[model samples]
Target: ENNKHVNDTENTLKRQKTNKKGGPKRDEVWEYFIVDDEKNDRHYPATYYHCEKKWQKGKLRTLKAHLSNECLQCPENISKFWRDKLSTELTNYTRKQKTIIQLPLKQYQITQHFSSDKPLPLAITERIDRSLLKAW
Candidate 1:
């Protein structure tokens, strides 16, 4: 009974660690893809579209681009609808992200991706350049 209790406690801890949410809500684009239990790997669905084209998971941007703008396999009308729908949804999401009023640099952090472990340099004179300012 003591061994059983220890095993149960370890299992419970594993479940708690793995049960964290996978980030934001599922996007509408997922509706178009088929979910198959037998074919699905641990991370991504085996097939990408209802048409059963091969695609990897965690490539949401690529998936959206294919469905919204470039998939010839999907019916033209469906592609057209998604193009409009995705465009509107992305626009709204961008607007919402832009409204976060934390700090001047917070906006930059929100828009940019930086995964380096190295600390930032003490000074960044490039930020003051006219071309960089205009681009931003």
Candidate 2:
């Protein structure tokens, strides 16, 4: 019984040390953003903003200050946000098409070439070529 108690104590200590070494969990960190009422009052890391230009233009204010000042809803700010959002969306869409759609199609064509299979239809090849050139 004494040996069993010692083993249980050792196990408890090991668990405590492991938990301490790992520090707070991911949910604890993310919960600061979602649950903390004062979160907006604190400074955030630099990568939080999507638009560098707008971020640079605005004086560094707490999130609460920005919201209270109506900066987020201002016409100029709204336009900037939309412009940045659209540009990012367009870039992502183009990249997805090129990599996911065009790349696989190109790979298939290459495989056909190696197998001495009939080449891809001329129209498809032409379209892919045009897109590749346009990307450049």
Candidate 3:
């Protein structure tokens, strides 16, 4: 049981909030703003991307420039809560003609767990992308 618990904990993705949004400092990516969209061109305004890192020595290191852009490791993605939220958001996004989001690997697995026993309806099922599903 202890080993199982440890395994569960190890599988989690650690997100350490290094800085706050809307602060005086002007060097970070926290949030993104959707400006305009067309068939190909889509503009995103000012946004922030806070750095995250795996735990070590009881602290976190900034992983912004060091890590590659494609890396998105989040523990919430693997939890059941994320799965339900993503599923719901996908449904809503579909109804609104919006696109489904892409979350990181661990986070994506958590997002899938939200569907436990009850699967989603058929309407939104068709638009779902398998790659995106595997991404989170």
Candidate 4:
């Protein structure tokens, strides 16, 4: 019985840790818009406008866009602050993504001749190139 109690306590702690790992803390944007419980679908995140009371389905960035670009519910001063904050965040994100995508790998250098045991056919090579480009 004592061993079972100790096991139960350990199991509860493990469950709590797993639960905490599943969800990150809510973003600050949640203060402006609230999840629309009535209209929310499990597959999508939904929020309602304060002024219009309309339900919108989108990710956090989409909500930020709405506040920064289209929403008229907030007062001029608050709206301007949010717009500037979101704009700065977007600019930083764009710069970071650009650097990550543009930076070339230093470890792998191209050679004049194919280093593989057998060179891939031209058709297969072109297909792979196209697929990678499309993926990016």
lDDT by residue for model 4 over 1-136, one digit each (tens)? 6875675566456535544655566466655544443335432345533464444564677766666667777667667877899878768874334544667756654553456767889999999999999999
Evaluated against the true structure, the overall lDDT of model 2 is 0.42
Query: Which 10 successive residues of model 3 have the least lDDT summed?
Result: 29-38
TM-score to true structure, per model: 0.41, 0.18, 0.19, 0.42
- Candidate 1 lDDT at 90 equals 70
Q: After superposition, how far is residue 66 of candidate 1 from its true place, in Å?
A: 0.9
User: Tens-digit lDDT track for model 1 on 8-82?
Assistant: 566456544544658655465654654333334444553544455766563567677878777678888878887
lDDT of every predicted structure (CA atoms): 0.61, 0.42, 0.36, 0.61
Clashing pairs in 4: none
lDDT of 3: 0.36
Q: How many residue pairs clash in each candidate?
A: 0, 0, 13, 0
Q: What TM value does model 2 have?
A: 0.18
At residue 106, candidate 4 shows an lDDT of 64
lDDT of candidate model 1 versus the reference = 0.61
lDDT of 3 at 58: 18
- Least well predicted 10-residue stretch by lDDT in candidate 4: 35-44
